[model samples]
Target: MVVVKGQDTSEPGGVPAHPAASASADAGDEAAEDDRRPSPDDLHELLAERGLAPDDVDQMVDVAAVGITARWWRNTKVEDWHAGSAIGALSDVDMYRINTHTTAKVRERLRRWRREQGLHTMVDVADADPAPLNRVFYNLYRWFTNPNRTLIIGTTLRDVVAQTLSNARTHPDCDVPDNVTTETELEDYDNQVAGAAGYLLESMDEYDPRSVLYSPALFATVWARRWWGLPDYPSHVDRVFAVLADPGHRTWQNRPIPPPPDGVNLVDVRKKMLTKPWELPDSVCQWLINDAAEHYIFD
Candidate 1:
């Protein structure tokens, strides 16, 4: 990152013309040092050297401001703004009082200073993956588009129930009642199945029923606390299975067999079973089988 400085007049030859040019070259060297990654301690040291107090720094600088100018500079293909320019923006008096503010505050101030210098984006200083900065950009973008808009977690128990019903309906062997259309109807069905599963789980305590639900290949682990009884335990297990079944869910594992319309043949499904057996109840497997069958048509 080259720091732009005032152009110096050079002699007719390639050499610098005067002693002032030598001083400028030295300042450029210092500026190069300033171009290194900025940290809280460095900012504090720079301010203390300048004799700025905390209150003085805050009054002159908006420490909370994002480094927009720095980002803009980088985006526009301008000379990189180094720390020297960031500190140089402050008045000598304000610069002297930099120690009074917290490190975080000073960091923000420096970031903002970089922004004021025409660096408007976070990517200007970002050394590696700009994911965090990208998120900030996204939030700002969202805010600008709709000030009243707020993010909400869309997943709900109703959604889980609906997903489970969808899975059952698509399964080759599982029997799903026709009347279970609405979310309310699905929830009732889920409750019934979960109750039965819970009873079975409790009765068969000698066997770790979870072994059936645990698929190492799928990276699926349905955890339940010891204190949780049948209905709750079964309900949670159903939820986990439902999540795994839906590709729309983030936790859904990618399978060699795609979803319906393409329709995977039984041979491929059997192959998948051998490699990564579905760790779910027989009832759940019925839905998975039906779902997998939809992905491809059999000969």
Candidate 2:
């Protein structure tokens, strides 16, 4: 939550304020603040000084960065979510003060940083099988809900998990495992989800699926899609179209969608869906932001 120093910080009606609204309101102040904030490269150098990498920052922050990946819209409504998530991610480092990498940039950093640590991306997972995805989530759910496990249920991660489970359980093709088959079963696990965004690998063995699946691309996309009321399985055109066609499913109010930026092809991008935006050109970052703001979620 973005707390203004002199304003009422209480969440009116208990509904979290929209990122765009908060961001737009604070744009002038944030621009001044950003001047004092470390650049992404500076942040990386600081992390290296303290023997940490981007991955050590925490998943929630990463997702938030991905949500507003491009610096193109900094100091705008787009920057609001980024500011909160980045600050939260930096809090985990105990040394560094901030992070500003997009999902693509973060993934690139991971590909390089993790390689130095002898970790590589999973290349053979031909399909994003929800069974494994659910299993990974199920374990994370267990960990998050466990009182013995000292974990802080940060806002971003809590929102991500809640949204992910909702997507997994509702997507027509999803075959949710019996263990986590019902909303009540999991809802009973924990009542209040709050705290600084974070993750703990201590209890997770080397072979744990989260080692590969607990990713912004893999896990956080659910939360990202939730912005536009999109469900899991981006490849599922039928479901995606169904959701798009239904006025009721548009969680946010309907708005005028502007023409996409030149040289940007939404169809081509969708065809290559889940291609890991960072792996492509930097423009993919721009394309995603354009799609989200002008075409999909906001206008």
Please name the candidate that would achieve the greatest TM-score relative to the true structure: 2
Per-residue lDDT of candidate 2, residues 94-190 (tens digit):
1011112233443454344334434332222212232443343344435444434322223332343344445545545343355652243224324
Residue 60 of model 2, lDDT score: 27
Q: Which candidate ranks first by lDDT, i.e. highest?
A: 2
The list of candidate 2 runs beyond 4 A from truth reads 1-3, 7-81, 84-199, 205-231, 236-256, 279-299
**lDDT (10s digit) by residue, model 1, range 1-299:** 11123423221111011111221222223323323322333333443353333223232233222112111111111111112323112222221121112222323544454455443332233222233333433343333223132212122324433444455455454444566454444333333223222322222232222111111101101111210111222344345445545667543345543342334454453444333333223333444435443212211
Model 1 residue 247 lDDT score: 63
What ranges in model 1 sit over 4 Å off?
Answer: 1-36, 51-67, 70-75, 78-299
lDDT of 1 at 146: 32
Models 1 onward score TM values of 0.16, 0.27
What local lDDT does model 2 show for residue 111? 40
lDDT of candidate model 2 versus the reference: 0.32
